[model samples]
Target chain A: MADFLSAYSIQNWLESCPQGYLEDTSYGHAVGEGEPGLLMDNEVLRNDAIRTTVQLVLGERCALAASSGLINAAPDEASKRFLATQTLDEARHVEVFTQRLYDLGVAKDDLESVLSTHANPHLVAFADVLLEKVDKKDFVAGVVGQNIVLEGMAFSVFEMMHAVNSEMNPKFCHVLSGTIADERRHVGFGENRIGSLIKEYPERKAEVEQMQKEMSYHMLATFAAAFQDVEAINELEKIGEERSHAKFQGADLGVMDPDEMEHLLADTVLGEFKTRLGRIGLEYQTPVAP
Target chain B: MIDDVHELRTDEFLAEVHSFEFWFQSIEGYLSDSTWGHDADAEEEAIDDEDRDRLISVLCNYCVGEAAALEAASGMIQIAPDRHSQIFLATQVADEGRHLEVFLHRLAELGVTDADAEIAKRASPSLLVFKDRLLELVSGKDWESALFAQNVVLESLEFVVFRRHAAEADTITSQVLEGVIKDERRHMGFGENELGRRLSRSPKLQQRLRDFRPELDALVLATLKETAHHLELDAEEERVLGKGYLESVERLGLLG
Candidate 1:
């Protein structure tokens, strides 16, 4: 019990976070690594990059709101403390992604406009479904939605982006690396802290599963819309052809189609959700394919 | 324990207060090296069980208050007027979380078996009044009122209480509170800088704040009255608390 407490302690967080992985970091990436000129200068690639990053920003914004709103509703000090750290991590995620917009050439004044303009409606619905649980102060449902589902999704998505950008975009890849680390911690907290609570309130399982199904449907739609962007994919391919190598989750992005990449990401995320949910004694509810 | 209040209206001051980096650095400086049982065993043998129980009771109430602060800080992030304020509130949430955790850790060290039940049992009616009022402000979504209630009203009360207790606290508790005191000071600075500016500009908002004060003041007095025996504060410390609370209110431009 002491070990569990110390592992999740704020002292551990401080030592592991700012003093550890985040030292000397500016906006979750190295200071000197700027966006690649080829992508920044090309109009098609720049818009595509901005479009992709806007989703990240919007997703992180939801994460920020959910994590913050769940703190007071947490049943124990440990959960409250973990959610508090998660709130800051989500906030940092928002800031870093919003910074990426500027790095991709969106003006500060135009940020909100671009975010709203580029935000996929399906993604917005996804956030709304999850935030409703948070707003109602349902810690069980909210954690499932935010930590298990949303963060689970973000973890895989970030990993995929990190892989593809590792060879081409050092700055974006660095940013994703930090967020991936943060998301891993958030998901772990969800599993460790909420498992007992779920056992205590076994009836909450059905309601949580229903919420997960609804959220999963919207998440799938979001992926569908994102992957079906032929123009962006073609432009990305053009840029990729010029580069040497790129891989996403071990699949060669140089030859893998957008649909295949989307499937890979979706499968990875859903697979994580199943394993993590089962660990906490909940069944995974599969949503209708978008 | 801020001995003298600093000027709140300078661009340099607001810039630093509003910056996330400033708060993050402050957190690392104060808390990075400390943990749950950092100095517990050394002090555990010195303090008697009755004293430990008294400390645990006081800390349980603190846990409740810190939880309220965590909730309020978390909600305020969304309604904060700008990116800087939002970012600052983010760090504030983390600070409140750390405060709550350290207190809980102390309770556990005191041989508390069930902290949740102990907290529920030990939290005074006065503390609940204070928490309910703060949560009311947060739920109402009046950003300025909530921020003022939290950063000014609640934080000022905590500042005084922690300062008073630090003198008599066992070594482990004192070390933990020394870190929390620094955080509360930073919170008070933010309230003074932010609310002082807003109150100076808007008479209506000022009046709303004025109307809200009596309830918070009543709660504070009731709380100090209730905890005074357990805390072992003397008349001089009470005088200091009264002076400090008034100074905090005055700094927020609430005084004539």
Candidate 2:
């Protein structure tokens, strides 16, 4: 009987955490006058924001669906309880992001079209692989892939976004702050469960390490594909410049470069993923360059 | 206001509020013949062949029902929209899992080693149809419809059946049924709370629920007839069971 973590403790933690609910008018201040990026003049910035929100909405929905499978495959009472709470968190993420997209002027049908057509294939494939692990009842693999890798990346990205855009997009920043706290707690569960598995069966360490390598390769592919979209990259670069200017007066917005911003995102996500793996007593094996 | 018809009379339930450990310990005690009056010497003389067979059949049906409830509860935890509901359903997954184990253990005491195979072999056509409909409801897109079928219909009927059987059975079996009935009542409470909240927000949904009642009642009746046949109930007994089920449904007032 695993007594290290109890379901009652998780229930208490969940109850104490802030519920993240965004109102319909929460984003009005970000898009209206006096905001740094007005829609009329910042079409590139506005389109990029909408596109990112749409992608997040789709990704969170995929996560929500996968949590269902994980709950079914959970090996014990504690894991089931933890995964159940995760399902709620993932569903809320989907709901909030969907509403955010709608607030950005995307209709429900248009949002669905974008999810089906414009979602990055590599990201979709990543979700599919994690879900497949859950279907196969490889509970450890599912936790490592979905919670440690995917959610670890989300935590890092959301933290960085919230820091940079707190003033420009207060509503989005507030939402990310709450979500980041939830993701941190989720990753803690993965670390605890994976650590226990390794201690019980030393041979399973090799299998988990191999799975992590495969996930890292997919993560790199997702990032590489994102960088290939010149328009989105250019818009990100402009937003980065604005953020830099806002932080320090007399900073030249012209000096902002897209490749630098891309490298920053990739490095932060990968670095955090490796750090998380180290905490669980697993070494991060570098994937072969593709 | 939501009517009292949707309320669960938790106070009337037999089992005290206990932790999962306590619940499992009680079940273990039952298996070991240390509790519920299953003395080693009396066990051999307590039941005749005919009575043993009837008990085994009833236990098999209970096992099948608990297995179905376990699956539905697992699925519900994933799709529940709010944290409180998800937490409740998660505990239910544990509760149903424990109940299934209890039934399997009780069957083992009767020299039935292969409980799953026995359940499959004894499952009637109507039971199979009910299982299929249950699977569809639990996996459907509308959460309220799932709640209506599982919590309001199947569980409601099971609660009444357990209550009736507990009243008539020996000390041991009655004790087990009492604990199970308590769990069933809590599960039904969750469904009522969720379904009531959803219906109150949308009058259209209330009408859809009203339209859904007959289909659910038909499924319940079909399962009841099959159960009566398995237990070899005469016309009066079948009529009594059917009437009890309908009265329970009327008390729920799900159609209105």
Candidate 3:
């Protein structure tokens, strides 16, 4: 009996977004805050930051494409409007993250090249799994792929990043906070809008669950690849700089190693994906462990 | 459906188009205005029964049209020439969705229980043809032709429709169209700059663009003729549609 229309209305978006959660924020971060001097001054730190931001840019770019592509495929006007806002949110994500790459010293002209250079094959495969559904204009599968799987992954990823950067990177942490908020809204929309839809078409559950399975494998692989590069973590530890005391989920980022953090992030993402998919009437298909 | 087409050159208006951050700021400026955020039924008391019925039927037709625009804008994001263009189209997709939402929200307030049924019942045949043509163009590989169909042809028609209606609309209707009209102008600016740049580069494309006109012009005129009857647009409004299209093409440097 909830008012679905009003909840997703542009007025609501206006009040809750630019006028609400995002008030006075510039480019999804605190105004005038630049990248930390430590990141700017150190070659190893800069390169590591650029690598991390490249993945974010790539992920956000995929998110932008998926959200925009889902608009036409959405069944109801409300869903379309929500997807539209999500599209902008995703585009903003791409922009802010791409800007972070610039802040990390990637030139404007070298952006595409840098993005190509650092492109994670596993992440690319993960996006391909979701984008295939978007391209086919499959609304149920697309939303499940985008809102539930991709966004759910993003929510945890941003939270983990936010926690890790809170001590040394205020600017990047602010950016992650905004994206974390946006991802939360997108995931909520997926659950609220797609639950009834999944109920109405019970047969779609199996196919969508299969997509989740495939995407999950690639997502886990992406995490493994990211954590495999422990040079930056090792380098940071050697610097004897301020460490992040933040806790992501139940894991203490200040104490966890790269492998442990990867496990924490991957487990948390898939765990939420299972819960969200279950709420929307789709049984989670467990992927072969990465 | 017509207004004074701005005679600004490419550089003049292209300077206004920025990334999504700027677009959000522009919208937020409007949101902070006193005129925005009107309730769905803000105009309900102002309209009579006869006018309300006509408004619902007419707005239903617009709901269909805006939906087509939303679909086209969404598809354009994938085919846009570069990251900058894709980013811009992403914002357009959101604008089109907001337009469709506001129109549908208004219709629902006017006692329209099922918007799809109302749209099917009330949408003019010419408008449906236009929608189908735009969709077909958008689905193809040619980004220029698709951008032309949506930004130039489709958005121009919407501009006219919104402008013509806002003049006689109640407070809520005017509020909706006010924001939509501004967004349409921004869309037109992008079309002119991007298309003009392409046209200036390729004489072949300019010729092909000029050649692609008659059928779409005929469709626009037919839709306008149909809309004139439904919305009671005067002779001047009818005349403005053709003039606006001409001015747009000329501004895009395709007139030669």
Instruction: Please report the candidate that would top DockQ against the real structure.
Output: 3
lDDT of 2 by residue, B101-160 (tens): 556667777788677688777655555666667767766646777777777777877887
TM-score (C-alpha, index-matched) for candidate 3: 0.93
DockQ of 1: 0.57
Residue A220 of candidate 3: its Cα lDDT? 92
Q: Enumerate the candidates' DockQ scores in order.
A: 0.57, 0.09, 0.58
The superposed Cα distance between candidate 2 and the true structure at residue A207, in angstroms, equals 3.4
* Selected candidate, larger lDDT, 1 vs 3: 1
Per-residue alpha-carbon lDDT of candidate 3 for residues A51-141, written as tens digits (9 for 90 to 100): 9899999999999989988887877777888888888888888888987887788987798999999999999999999899999999999
Pick the TM-score winner.
Answer: 3
For A107-216, candidate 2 gives per-residue lDDT tens digits of 75576676677687777877777777766767777788888988887776676566556666776776676678778878888888877776776777777788777777
Q: Which ranges of candidate 1 are over 4 A from the true structure?
A: A1-6, A236-244, B1-19, B37-45, B48-50
Q: What residue pairs are clashing in model 3?
A: B1-B160
Instruction: Write one digit per residue (lDDT tens) for candidate 1, span B172-248.
Output: 88888888899899888777878888888999999999888887888887777666767877777677787788788
Q: In candidate 2, how many Å is residue B99 off?
A: 14
- Each model's lDDT comes to 0.83, 0.64, 0.82
Error of 3 at B181 (Å): 0.7
Q: Which 10-residue window in model 3 chain B sums to the lowest lDDT?
A: B1-10
